[model samples]
Target: MSMLNAMRQKSAKAERSCVAPGEAGCDPVSDEANGPRRDTESTGSGLLQAVLTRENLRQAWKRVKANKGAAGVDGLDIDQTARHLVTAWPTIRDQLLLGTYRPKPVRRVTIPKPDGGERELGIPTVTDRLIQQALLQVLQPILDPTFSEHSYGFRPGRRAHDAILAAQGYIQSGRRIVVDVDLEKFFDRVNHDILIDRLRKRIDDAGIIRLIRAYLNSGILRDGVVLERYQGTPQGGPLSPLLANVLLDEVDKVLEQHGHCFARYADDCNVYVRSRKAGERVMALLRKCYGKLRLKVNEAKSAVASVTGRKFLGYSFWFAKEGVKRRVANKPMATFKQRVRQLTRRSGGRSMAEVIERLKPYLLGWKAYFGLAQTPGVWRTLDEWLRHRLRAIQLKHWKRGSTIYRELANLGATEHVAKRVAGNSHCWWRNSNGDIKRVLTIAYFDKLGVPRLS
Candidate 1:
């Protein structure tokens, strides 16, 4: 038989053999002629019961269509899977319901980091990705409420800014010390057995549990060759973030039980206390809890210091003349400047308009984020620096005094003024603040689609 005929035959068999509701066991495949096996009974409040619904499958298919990732170990891209999903959904859904669906091995790709190193990223097969999306839709509501308010990370309607704001509130309320904790290789360090064991307490469906276990165990790293990954969840898998948050729920509970004031954004945690003694107590408790959970702490990055002295989620809390103030940290600002310079570099061989077009998104996003903090001075300084860089780029683009003079004249500069400005100096900084500065005003740059911090 052809592949389509074979799949249709299998699906038809599965549907006919599927156990009905109120059966002893919900197992799709069972030896019992009368009903399903007792162990497979669906008695829990878990949302996996809705997995096989056509609506849920459609939703899953929509998510797959929206993704922009590459093909997985199965060598099927989103477009290819989409083309086959209409024909494939029946068998896939039947196998999922029967607890017989096996996920393909995860494809690992290494991404280059800023410091010239690489990080492993796992991509799941298109089918598995669809299943993961469906699972997320079902599980998110159940798991979202269990997450702590101070923990932000991947949760919807929460962000690093929220974490910073929460920490700032505590600091304003007289929390003196802030203990920052960094988890060492947090995603890669999760123990699969422990994660599954904990998951069993909340979820009771065997099919769902089996699916999760398969996802956890299906990771395969190939660096020009297949490599072994003995433990921990895959970092880049669709389900990894949810699993990591679920696993860390225990840590949140432990901190709450000890009455520790804390804010967590994924593996980055900041514990606030009234004094050094309280900070020490919280830090010790955290160490014990982490030890019990087999999580490693990066001691070098972790520190218990004054709230004014530490930075969390790229924002720093400090006492100013008015009150406690929140502002962007030095490191992130420096990095932002470096990125802007790199993107707007004169020698990059891109046109001035092209460079500005590329920088619009980055500039807008960075400004929107840091704008949350009260930093008008910082914004003004950055705006001046950026305008100067643009001026330098424009000068480099002009390349010749004749071109510069013509450009200045075109911008309505008087001929004499343009000649003087163009002949002033070859130095970009001097020229940017001199004649070119007048010709290319902030309004002029704005007209050319250059984003400015205000």
Candidate 2:
């Protein structure tokens, strides 16, 4: 009988901790303020009134998050994983790191096409030597433990880095109008046939080709939620970044050959020409380039705006309304928050708070997306929220623990009132404290962004 009672208590406590309407009220997963289970001392209003509905929860979440920047998560895993892969190829890495090996061997030639048109070009022979060097050069830096997943690919902010070079007179601007080009799903959508064609041009060894094919094709999804699964081969594989780097390097050569001066750091590409007429020529060349590669640009999310502090790969590329601006690696939190607000606002009033509230679904889907280590940024935000709460409670005994918490979102139905209770634990908590003599009054009282407890 005692064991049965204990079991019931445990089950009830589990039920109470969720945010959905039907279950026992749980705190926000992003808030991490939910303490160990304690028996509820029910106020006259009961726990139901305390919980917020999903709609209200969404609203409040956006209001807070839009005002604050979203954080990077599981970025470390990509770093460490990349390091391990690179270090696995030591000789190539050493050669590339020391700059002792030349990966791209320049071969100048004129080739005849099926249309009987011949063109002079400098084609790079993609040798094993080049491949190894490329991998090593890209991988060695990321191997450092400090590198986070957010740092994996070359970021868009590299343009600002080049702009600095122009400002410093290292490179003359030369009346160039620069247009940035971004490809949609560069890796995931890579056609195996195209890759094979490219690979065949370099190596004739059938064994090596087979080995590479199997290695590249083995992009089997890791065990996880279906939507989050990625192919294990070159698409989502550890070596894909390096491969993509080499591919883009080839693309860069093609762009420059057609009279478009190019600057590319990873997938973020910019084409610069000597005049506005040249800029039109550059854009035309870009279309040709993408068409040849069987790739397309996502023009909707991408733009040719007079760039400001546009973030790419976790760095800030600040472009002046007219001239190029300095390349700053990290923007202040305030700057980042403003950009987040702008992006959210531009999202057709997707309503920032609601998007943040919806972040729970992503937070819960973390296991599906990257793995156990790659949780949503909201979890850390929640922890910070809890620490504040604990400080107010004057509770010094609390210590942090692993974030291996279970999903509370999928627990109940959207139609059920209990499910509604489970979905919005915040309202539940607030309503529960309605009659309490001393509960902190939270209000958006100041524009300085002080989350107030009046």
Lowest lDDT sum, 10 consecutive residues, model 1, at 31-40
- What's the TM-score of each model vs. the native? 0.88, 0.37
**Relative to the true structure, how large is the alpha-carbon lDDT of every model?**
0.75, 0.36
Report the alpha-carbon TM-score of model 1 versus the true structure: 0.88
**Stretches of candidate 2 above 4 Å error?**
1-176, 222-236, 274-277, 305-324, 327-454
Pairs of colliding residues, candidate 1: none
- Write model 2 residue lDDT over 341-400, tens digit each, in one string: 433332243432443444334333322322221123533554344223322221111111
Number of clashes recorded per candidate: 0, 37
Candidate 1 lDDT by residue in tens digits, 152-221: 9888888878888888888888887987888888877888678877787877665566678767766484
